[model samples]
Target: MSHPLVIAYHLVWTVYGSWLPNDPRGSGSRTVRFDPLADLGDIHLGRKRVQPPRREVREFYDHAADLLKHPVLDLDKAARAIVGAALGEVVAAERYTCYACAVMPDHVHLLVRKHRHTAEEMVTTLAAASRAGLVEAGCRDPAHPTWTAGVGWRGFLEHPEDVRRTIGYIERNPLSLRLPVQRWPFVVPYDDWPLHAGHSPNSPYVKRLRAAGRYP
Candidate 1:
């Protein structure tokens, strides 16, 4: 059966002060911010949501830029295009089957199969390729870092349903923000997975997944 993956990463620009390690929602690391919420005691309650400290919201905004190595990144059309192209090249070179991707102005979402590389390696390579592409396009500043210091968020997709849901979410993210639909040349057809109507399903990849009972 094809391994499913759903990887979501926010750019350094998007996370600046909005969602720091100190966020009351819980943090990924201590270096990002001094999370006072971590001091409040056990916040994990199974699947329940943890509320952030109301005061730290303002604190995060105050020190957002100070925490970043570069100024906030607001990608223009050219920048997004460069990153998208670079992402496609990396995917093809790595031999991972890409299902969906959304290269938002400040972040990116990807749904792919875990192939020869681990998810962490995939994301790191993608970040590096994207940075190089930005540099080539003259969109990246030489004086500052292109991406955030640490690796962005990573999650595993355990089921075909998860894969389908995640892809839909990624595809519809721009619309959810009231932005225009994101169409890019790098978005390859995901023949291995179930697609909305009108997409052909005549690939060997789809046949394998179907034989494995991974897709309907």
Candidate 2:
């Protein structure tokens, strides 16, 4: 059987399709270019601008990540509830071992166990559910886009040491080797962890990658 994996995927999208060049604000008018670090050869997977994005676009992206706070308790209850509930369901249905989750206004952070599904499936389900939930809650307006275009990252778990690293990043302070397992593992990388890769838990590659700070 294929070994299970620990994966963490972000809602890679930005509001108003801000990351793509096809949108009005995303057009060259903003002098935006793609991110050099993530770009592949000549193909720009994302957009950048010489000038900052228009206020509206900036506000939209900013708001998407900010509304993560409890909207109902605050002002945007419907939006917050959608994310909160959607994350809960995603965790429950997938039976993922969740590490740490933070629902940012525009996006969410889910460190979940990697199991039967692929990273693509996990992200897709989360996005769909969150969108549906928002609509049901009367927060998602048809006039505005529900999601950007894609998710942020679906980093595959690379090794035990790396898993520890990510857990820390997600702020999971495991108790004395302890804590009731949150769900599955909390954070699973794409699927390259030593254990997930069918290698000995202390495989040398894990060590090397850790030393190089590229394990994840």
Candidate 3:
């Protein structure tokens, strides 16, 4: 049998202007806008940097708040549902396996297997679909974007343990935040994943992946 070409990714993205580039609490150089006084260190395009310090990060947020076009994102229930459905549709249409996802008020977490697309491409497509859904649902204004410009954070899940840990994190994010358990229609179980039982044992996708030993 041909080895499965399963590649997994754990992705994180924030709402527009929610987590700024100059955020003191550690930020990426790509997210920072042009600023005269910004003390940018280890300048690398689209890479995360260790935050300067908690006090410094807080100060930056305090000062930068006035310059923000929008306040911190806190999506309502309707908006969350719209975005979740949109993400699910994108996954299905792209033939990607979505292991888990969480749509938080300010950001989102997704664990998906890459197929016929790069991680960046998947993030961009998902963001675009979500923005359109939000606008169509009247959850967001068409004139304003709902997501940050670039992909926020992405890490490859090269090992089965990594995939398992990420899936746990995505599933438990809401509970960790002291919020109600998140349940969305988009989350699908992988039959080959021994860590989690498959929801549909007879599903063709599950069977194919299982037969090919593509659990991770």
Candidate 3 RMSD to the real structure? 6.0
What TM-scores do the predictions have?
Answer: 0.68, 0.51, 0.75
Off by over 4 Å in 2: 1-78, 171-216
Error of 2 at 66 (Å): 21
Report lDDT (Cα) of residue 119, candidate 1: 71
Task: Write out the backbone clash pairs for model 1.
Answer: none
Q: Estimate candidate 1's alpha-carbon lDDT, on a 0 to 1 scale.
A: 0.62
**Candidate 3, residue 20: lDDT:** 70
Candidate 2, residues 47-153, lDDT tens digits: the string is 44454447855564444344332221211434655666776787777786665554544445566655687777777788778777777777765444566545545
lDDT of 1 by residue, 1-216 (tens): 454333322222232233445444654554533354344333332222755576855665455556554576666778877888998898778776777787776677877765667777777888888888888778876655666556667767654566667777888987876777777655666543344465455555455546667555
Best prediction by TM-score: 3
Among these predicted structures, which one has the highest lDDT?
3
Question: In model 3, which regions exceed 4 Å deviation?
Answer: 1-6, 36-59, 70-72, 192-216
